[model samples]
Target: MATGSRTLWKGAITFGLVHIPVGLHTAASEQGVDFDWLDKRSMDPVGYKRINKRTGKEIDKDNIVKGVEYEDGKYVVISPDEIEAVFPKTTQTISIERFIGANELPFVFLERPYYVAPINKSDRVYALLRETLASTGKIGLAKVVIATKQHLAALVPSGPALVLSLLRWGDEVKTLDALELPPAGRGNVSAAELKMARQLVEEMSGPWDPADFKDEFRIQVMKLVEKKAKAGEGQTVLQPEEDAPAHTGEVIDLTALLQRSLKGGGKPARKTPAKKAGAKEPASKPATQKKAA
Candidate 1:
């Protein structure tokens, strides 16, 4: 579970006669290793330079101006003062428009999530709202202006805290009809195929465990980095097993594949590659073993 961090935005939830003061805290963070660019010859850090595309000349910050391209290759430069003049008024309030069933909104509409906490001794009111939403299985549809742009968001209760998830505008979501997909039940799904597929799904179903999911690629990459740093340059590092070759231009037997997968503990075993000629294989230890000094 994520704990509350520094407050990002402060506001009040308002709809009808009800009002609850709250503060929004960031709920998630980006994960993965960040690599910096470097000059290979000098082994020095490399920095990005702003360059004019046509002239291939470096540009300075003062040389740039904000503009909107209303016509092809034609832009109207707008100043910071002009933009701030027309900015949406920051009411610092989440004006909820209506309440709907919690499940009514599609998952696709939800975007960034933030943890909502009571501010300025409004704990009791916050608890009331959270309990009411949890008991009734309802969520609040609200609009808020944050950082300049206005956004539609869903306010719902999760455990002890209220969560406000930013939503995409209706126009932002593409229509499903645009894709030329086959209609439901229009594809050639035989009775036996359907039955087997259902059985496979049922057999594989289990309780949701988020802890079981992990970024194995990131883990392995970091491990490789550690090994290389210890081994220094000009050393060969052992590799992990690669995935089997994908079938190409051949007819696939979906039913047979499902049956075999189900029988073989629901997952296929990976094939280890053969060593190259005259390459002596080292004794295998855990992948995270420290390189010898």
Candidate 2:
């Protein structure tokens, strides 16, 4: 696919021996209708007005400066120059601090994603970092300042390119322990239950594949939108049924459990030697007949 020339954040990835200059480009985008608030009588598009909550009056942009309330009912205004003074001058480095396993970080910590590409003709260095991370099964954790605030990000090998996922800081994430919950409190899981879960898991194993999944809701919504546009009338489409997925009990063996589950559950699988052709033969066998004298 052809890539856009928009650079979200221009920076460099730093490590022990690697200081690869790269630019961060957004890897994804939101696609949908853009709605505007308008004056119904005149059909004039409305622009938002900044209003004071206490006074219930519109405030001018010049009067609405950035401020943080240090005390009750009072805020000290800060200027643009004050904000600019803290901004980082260099927009050419990612500055990797350390490398750690990707799974070590919680999913809640990940906030945003950006594609990292080498600067000018530094493709060689970019490829080196991508390959190194891929081989070692590790992700690079780095701190880079973009705009005014600094961000914590994880550098990961994403297909032919590198992706940097912006992460929430230590103070940003509140631990679940604050809820005063007991150990493994919510889910009523036990040893046998865990074993059954494992059995079900082994039964439904499959290779990692991203192409198999997609945003079905998005596709359907777009289709409805296109139909309305052509018809010149808005119409709602019926939502599809949410079927409960059948989960098999966790089998004892991860490998064999998958094969048997596929056989029993009537799901077609690969024709490997381990995955037999007639997995349901044992279950389908008829009872023995009595012999007549």
Candidate 3:
């Protein structure tokens, strides 16, 4: 009985010994300045029109055709059929390839994320995908062609919902080994400094809480803009810049610490020894204040 105008992308999730039909709906959106070309002279609307650079004339829209270039002087014209041939025949299913451990790749490789939801009495199957991934501590690697373009996506379970993050191909990401990296050498480090560093970290350590942090810049910007608009000024105001604390970290000391850890136990924090549990020491008897008569 859900109403209103939100259409879900109907699809089927596929994996070995598992296949579930589901639908994907966008959980978020980018709502910002939607820029458009304008005519400064006329103060009227300006729009895009097809113009041939070589012909020096505006070409009719119907006459235009999409083409792809392979070489300096080679090209291939692509029709609607040519493009459709590559897309999944039905838009009803997003086929999942395999599930993988979340930490198998770094965050840098993650691209854009979308919320995928179930559609039309598909909650049971949707829950299956969500709980299965959640229990395994893994994300599903899947291919979904939305519109005419195919996407390499990672289906990550986010609470009761699922997040599909688009991924880049292996070839698109350049190999790190091919690049010149910084030297792995670790210079000598003081034992005292290392101990202090350990103490500093211990002082600041706490459990992970995602809700503890947010984009302060974005929130500040929104507030500032809102305040300005209420005062009838539409201009965007930049916040005053704050200077970062001086970084006195030396490269070698860090590397040495890392190596020490890898070689089993770098250094433990010096903590005050706790009093023996359940063994209360006798209270110190204060000398009775002798009255000097």
- For model 2 the local lDDT of residue 121 reads 41
Candidate 3 residue 139 Cα shift, in angstroms, is: 2.0
Error of 2 at 30 (Å): 21
Every model's TM-score:
0.53, 0.54, 0.53
Residue 53 of model 3: what lDDT? 46
**CA deviation > 4 Å runs, candidate 2:** 1-64, 88-90, 146-149, 180-190, 232-293
Model 1 collision count: 0
lDDT of each: 0.56, 0.54, 0.52
Q: Please report the candidate that would top TM-score against the real structure.
A: 2
Q: Model 3, residue 231: displacement in angstroms?
A: 3.0
Candidate 1: residue 139 lDDT (0-100): 85
Query: What are the per-residue Cα lDDT tens digits for candidate 3 across 80-190?
Result: 587667545433234456557888966756777777655434455456557777898987776655544466777788988877787875545543443333556534656
Pitting candidate 1 against candidate 2, the one with the higher TM-score is 2
For candidate 2, write residues 222-257 as lDDT tens digits: 999889889889656999997643322212233454
Query: Highest lDDT among the candidates is held by which one?
Result: 1
Give the Cα RMSD of candidate 3.
28.0
Each candidate structure's count of clashing pairs? 0, 12, 4
**Cα misplacement distance, residue 187 of candidate 2 (Å):** 11
